[model samples]
Structure formats: C-alpha cells, structure tokens
Target: MTNHKVDTPSKIEWTELYNQLLDKVDVGIHVIDEHGKTILYNQKMMEIESMESDDVLDKDLLEVFKFHNNQHSTLVQSLQTGKTTKSKKQTYFNNKGQEITTVNDTFPLLQGDRIVGAVEIAKDVTQLEKVIKENVLRKQNTKFTFNRIIGQSEMFKSVIEEAKRATRTSSSVMIIGETGTGKELFAQSIHNGSSRSTKPFLTQNCAAIPDSLMEGLLFGTKKGAFTGAVDRPGLFEQADGGTLLLDEINSLDPALQTKLLRVIQEKSIRRVGDTKDKQVDVRIIATINEDPLDAIAANRLRKDLYYRLSVVSLLIPPLRDRKEDLSLLANSFIDKYNAMFQMNVKGLSEDAMQMLYQHDWPGNVRELEHTIEGTMNLLIEEELITAQSLPTKFRRRYQNSQSSIPEIDYPSLSQDEEIKPLRDKMTEVERMYIQQTLEANDHNISQTAKILGISRQSLQYRLKKYHL
Candidate 1:
C-alpha cells in the first residue's frame, strides 16, 4: 500500500481561497453580523448594489442600504428569527439611490447554536421585473376572430371547426403547432368566440422567463412580502373570467409545471408570500411548439400537467401540409398588403403562383404572409405579381428546383431550315447561358459575373445587348 502525504493549507490561504470562490460566483453574496453590521460582501453583491467593498465593509447595514424598515432586509430577518429564508424577494435603494430588487436565499450562520451572522445569496431581478411589466403583463384586447382566419383546405377547415367547438366550452385548451403557424391567432379567435369575449385577454411567452420570476408573474404578489412588493394582480387575476394564454408552456420549469397543474385542478391561486388562496375564474389556453409526447418523453414537459391542460388539445397542421390552400392564402395576403401598401396589384401571375406552391413553407403562414408583404414592397407599376417580382432568395429556390431540368429548350429544326448567321447563333447561345447562370445565382450581378468568369461591366454590356 502506498501512503500519500497531503500538505494542509494554512488558515490565511484557506480564507483567501474562500474569498476568491465567493467573488467568482455570479449570484450576489452578502454576510452581516448579528448586530446588522456588514462583514462580508462579494464582488457580485457590489455589482448588484453598485457599491464598493470600501463603502460597505464593517458599515451598518441600515446606513449602507436604504430599506423601508429593518424587517425589509432578508439577512436581518434570518438573523432575528435564527432561521433560513429561501427564495425571498427583497427590494431596497442603495446609497446610489437605485432601487435594487433581488431574489435572496438567506441563512443564519450558527456556531453551536450561538448566532454569529447571516449569509445571503441574491439574484438581481430588478430589470427582469421591469421588462415583464412593460412587455408581458400588458393586456391585449385581441381583435382576431374566426372570420379573419382564412383557409379552405379540408384539414385546416376541420381544425378550425374543432377550435370553434372548443370555444363553446370553457375547458382549458392546448394548441400545438410549429412556430408561426398562427397558434396565437387560433388562441385569440377561440377567446373572442367564447363567453368571456368581453373580458381581458392576456399572454405570456414562458420559454425565456427565469424560474424565480415565473411564480410571481403567474400568481399575484402580497404587499410586505418582500422589500418592495406591493399588492399586485398576476396574469390570472388580471385575466379573470377571460383567457390567460401561456405560450410555449412546455418550456416552463418542472416545478412550475406542477404548480400550474395544481392551479388547474383547484381553480384558485395563492399570491406569493400569502397564506390565503383566492378563487380565480380564469381560463387557461396554453400553446406548445413541439409534440407533447416527445416533450414528455424528454422530460421537458410533465405528463400530468399535459393531461390537465390538454382537455381540448388542438394540433394545427403546418402550412406545408396544407399546400392546397396556397392560392387562397396568397390572394388574401395580396388583398391585405394592397390595402396596407396602397398598391392596386390585382393578383399573382401563374409563374409566381407556381413558385409559391413549390415552397415548403418551413415558417408556415407567417412566412407566406411576410413573403407577400415583401414582394409587394418591390412592386411599382406592375398590376400583377410575376416570378421576377418575387424576393430574390425565393426566386433562387424556384430556379434551383428547375436546375434538374434540361438547361436548353432547343427550337425544332425544319427539313428546309434557313441557315442563320454564325454570329447570331453564338449570340443566342451566349444569351441562354447567361440567363441560366443569372437565374441559378438569384440574378445577383456580381455572382453571375463571377460564375461566368466575366467582369460585372462585361455582364451588364451583354445583358443590354441581349435585352436579358
């Protein structure tokens, strides 16, 4: 057996290592003595509070940071109660007079049951809360209705019929579709058709929200619960008797998924830091852009929550799957853009329609809508849209698809054919070659010239000579 000798680190070295580790962490850390004097404040805490160690070290916590009262401090609360506080939101102004909000987990340090100090771990959510308020919390009185949804395909019609049936009942709905497939459109239409059409309609995209903010954002917050918390109604409360659309619900944290399931079962919500539950008559309409079974198998979504929210599950087919409606949808977009762009464009040409029908529409309806909007922006005097007026990238896709066909369509030779001049024959061949190269490369002058081993000026001269 081999014995390994280990050199123990000195007390000073150990202390330095601990300080370095604390400074390197992303979360803000602060420790104060039982008497409420700052003892340890890490680099992140300084960044969060916008102060230096010199400004906070050994200073009284009350003097260093402005609080409504001593009870507002999580560190002080933990110190006084001799207990740990987890995920408590605290808001206060620093000496810089900036209102800082943080979600803190504070623990009291004990030396054999004798209170020494309390250490706090905080995550800054001041800016996040502001963004949520400005963007996510605002109510949108949706104007979309079933009449506005346009699609004549049997599959699409059946899906719309199913959605219409859903509106008749108040059961929770789960809309599943690819991104930009008008999941939100269907959601809004369903809400407008429902009995709660006069009520508020709210939405929140759950994919990017941090876990700490999700709870309070969904459920209301109680005043005095945190340093700066006020009595605020959450999405459920704000959308009472209406619909609260939680888009991308599968992206939510599993713990929150459990909470959501509870809310669905109980039909009530308890505000953050509140002891009492409030009954809310809000209807939830959740949407996910993935296969629910796949999400559940990957553990991204909880099966139990899926079962609860999917009482009226809807699978909206992607645009590619319903290509039969391409012409109808294109004409609708043409009409819409005509009014918006003040253009009198009548319709799409046959060639342009063929190109549109060839597209797989990976972005679904939104992509098609934008394509029409974009194509119309380039139209000037043309009354009808031609393939030439389509976006360059779109035209390139159509051209590339045609690349597999024979490059030249030779004119049929007659038995008594009249011979043309050699120069004319060469010019005809050169024009056809240049035209093919131009179409293949999205008609980009520089790219076509480069592919043909000619300068841009040379290509421009040839294009004019051939009237290409």
Candidate 2:
C-alpha cells in the first residue's frame, strides 16, 4: 500500500517494560505460578531475601522460601482461598538463616476466570530504629487534644469534664475501658493538656513487656545487675517532670505491682543494682481494659495500686450504651478515612448508617475506624458507603442482626416508555435485592434465605426464576 508503515510492539518490549515497572516499585514483590514455582519477581524481593532472582526463579516457593510452607502464612492462605489477604504481620527466616519480620499483603492473581498465580507486596518491619522513628512521628503528628475525643452524649460529656479537671493537677489518673475503647486517646490528651505537656511524655503497654523485663523498663537498671546490663534510665526517669502512661496496667505481675505502689507512694525509685533511692517527679497514668474491682478480685491488679491510680478516674461507656453518638462517630470516621485514603467519600447511606446504629460495636471506636478505612479502600469506584458496598465481614454481621434487610435501588422509568404493572416492578426489585444478598453471602442458599427473612423454598424459587 503506498509505503505505509505499521508500528507493532516487539514481545521483548512488553517483557522489558513489565520488569522495569516491577523493579521501580519500592515494596518487595513476589509472584508464583499455580504450581507454587517462582515465575517472576522484582529487585526488592531479592534484597529482602538476600538472594538473586536467578537462584530463586523456577524453584518451588515452599522449598526455597521458609515462610511459604507455614500454615499461618498469608501467601499459603491466598493459594487455598483464592482470596486476597491484607497487612498480616509475619516473622520468618530467610534463605541466609537471617530472621525477617514484615507486613505482607498477598492476593491471588487471576487470568480471565482462572487463578493464574499469587502475588505479595511486603513492607519490612524488622528495622527497629525505623519503626520506632515512624511511631514517634505518628504520635507527634496526631498530638491528641481534648476536643479530639469526640462525643456529645451526656455521659461522655461528664467524663470529658472530669478528664479536663484531672489535667489541672498532677494526681494519678486511672482510665478504665474495654479493649479498643479510646483509653490511650484519653491518656495522650491528658498528657498533652497538662502544664508538663512540653516535657517528655512516654507511654508503655504494661501487658507487652515480660515481668523480668518490665521492672528494668519502668525502673532504671544499673550496671552489674544482669549480664551486659549497663546503667540506664527507665521510663519513670526518662519521663521525669512529665506523664508516664502504664497502659493495660492490670497485666502487671503481683510482685511488680507491689513495687509500682511503692514508687507511687514515695515518688522515688531505686535502680536494680543501686543501694540508694532516687527522687522522681513523673505523674503516672494507668489504663486497664477490665473493671478495677474485677481485676482486684481476680488478683490481676493490686487493690493498693488501684487506689493510688484512681485518685482521678475516667470510665468510658461502651458503644452500645452510646447509640446517640453513632451517627456523629460515623461522620467523624468518614472524614478521617477520606483524608487518610485520599478519597472523597461524602457519607454513609441511610441503610448503612442504620446498620451501624443497630449493631453492637464490641471492638468500640478503634474497630469503627478500621471498618471505615477498609470499606473506603474497597470503595474505589464509589463516593458513598452503602449497605450493599460494606465489606463482607461487616455485611454478614449486619445481616445476622434483627434489623430489616437493605433493598437495592430500582431504576426509574421515563414517562414516554410503557410502564410495567406494579406487581411486575415489585417482583423485579425483590429479585434484584435477593440476588445482591445472595452474592454477599457467597451464594449460600440457607444463609441468603436467613438474611433475606424468607423461607428456604421461596428463596430457591426466586433463585431458579432469576437463573442465578
């Protein structure tokens, strides 16, 4: 044809482009075929494993990657379920025998209708210094204030007023709440609002550190006390003239709790190897995830220690008792997730909001925040959170509740077109809603019928009629 030139991409061009793109990504990327043989990977994976691609390629991942063979491994779970697993913290040994700790998000890669393989994106958490620095930065950025503890309910209001009064003095504060309630938020707010706000504010989760290590971490350790132990200041010393938060204080061992009571009473502490007591001016703030009386009864917390810490107490009510605040909390979370995930989610739909209101939030505010963030991540193509669009975990929970099932929105017809009979329109709407409910429950006929509030036979008839 008149010297026409058609430009066709070479097979090598696409492979080179894909490899270049993979290498440019910052996080570790690993891909394995259906047989678990390493098919393609990037430079970052090699760096994380301390191995070259040539050595790993064509090898069975389970045999080469020590983490792959484990039952709890996300990659293995993805292969079994053909589903994506996100942000699972895992610790494993590499090929070089070096231990590695990372947060991995793995997904099953699909080609058309078949699962071709799986891919994982990994973020290293083994670097303690980096993780610590990031935590410090995050704490600094959030900088909790009194106004940030959002709730307008009278009970919450009374608690806030009492909390503000606690900030005016150096008295010890005891914050009691169930897990996932905003115990730490109140602690941080109290510390930041106090006159010693500019001073060193430190927080330690008492439940996290072992009893043997807890003593040295809360009270300084001196040289010769233990092998290779150098003289060092602990949290009480480091947080001098500021606030020290002992989170989950009920987890403290009986012996350690006695020592803690002594320190609080005398306002001093002695190093593990030292013979003399050293004076300190740190204000203690202890939080417990259980009732103080119950904890004392169970011997989990000391009665004397509880009295010292409860000089000023703040008891946060559970979410179920604060239904008046659900809408407010939901809107606040929506705003937060909008900024966090960089999306423009306007608000929750009526059914979605109703679902939230009806369900008892056992995990409290933290759980709500996580749900919002996760739902926002899944709403890539939408601006609002609807009942149908909620994550399966929440959807199933909501469906199990006694609340009415949410119906899908039916399309409106134009006046120029022939209008269907009322019965036909209703049938179409009902069928569509049933189909959505069935999909949400992964086509479990019994569960679908239960969620839809109908007999199994009726659900079966509809499913057959709809050919779904």
Worst 10 residues of 2 by lDDT: 127-136
Off by over 4 Å in 1: 1-123, 126-138, 223-230, 400-468
lDDT per residue for candidate 2 within 246-297, as digits (tens), equals 8899998899999999999999999888898999999999998876866888
Best by lDDT: 1
Q: Which candidate has the top score in TM-score?
A: 1
Report the C-alpha displacement of residue 246, candidate 2, in angstroms.
Answer: 0.3
Reference-based TM-score of each model: 0.64, 0.59
Give the TM-score comparing model 1 with the true structure, all chains together: 0.64
lDDT of 1 by residue, 1-468 (tens): 999999999999999999999999878989999799999999989998889999999988878888875447888888888988777778899998998888788999999989999999887778667755654434554879999998987568877989999999899999988898899889999999999998888888897677877888889788766644567778788888889999999899899899888998999999988999999998899999977877898999999999888999777877876788899898999999999888999999988888888888889899999999988998899999998999998787795775576678777879898788976776778889999999999999878988986545446546755788
